[model samples]
Target: MMSALVLYVTDDCSLCDQALELMAAAGAPDFQSVFIDDVPALQTTYGWRVPVVHDGHRGRELDWPFDVAALRAFLQPG
Candidate 1:
């Protein structure tokens, strides 16, 4: 089964765009995207770290600068 994952992102973010590309290359499972632009708390937490992959099932977060392999590992179920 696929794990629950959330991709925290923002508008006009190049890195976030790259993250989507990497996820596709890594064959990522179904996930939800949450924009941080309008949420103050989200902005505070992920302002500098857009394109973050949050593993809701494991309560883990994978920050940017991750490659396809890393994304694959993050998408793996426990």
Candidate 2:
């Protein structure tokens, strides 16, 4: 099975919503949304940076305010 990207986000976060839209616009690879609120570790790690995209396979993370070019690069293999 292919490893899916993980998107960390919190409820009612406008930036998170923008990130989702950007991902769709960038034709992002398969990904799963994880609410940081539900996971303590995640909440602690990404509480301040809610709209984060974790590339588990590459062990990299893309923070918010990224453009399509950056998104494509983040999706690329290392």
Of the candidates shown, which would achieve the greatest TM-score relative to the real structure?
Answer: 1
* TM-scores for every predicted model: 0.91, 0.90
lDDT of 1 by residue, 1-78 (tens): 554888899999889989988888999888888899999999999999888999888899999989999998877777
Off by over 4 Å in 1: 1-3
Assess candidate 2 and give its lDDT: 0.88
lDDT of 2 by residue, 1-78 (tens): 645698889999999998999999889978998898888888889999879999887788998879788998888776
Clashing pairs in 2: none
Cα miss at 51, model 2 (Å)?
0.4
Mark the 10 consecutive residues where model 2 has the least summed lDDT. Answer: 1-10
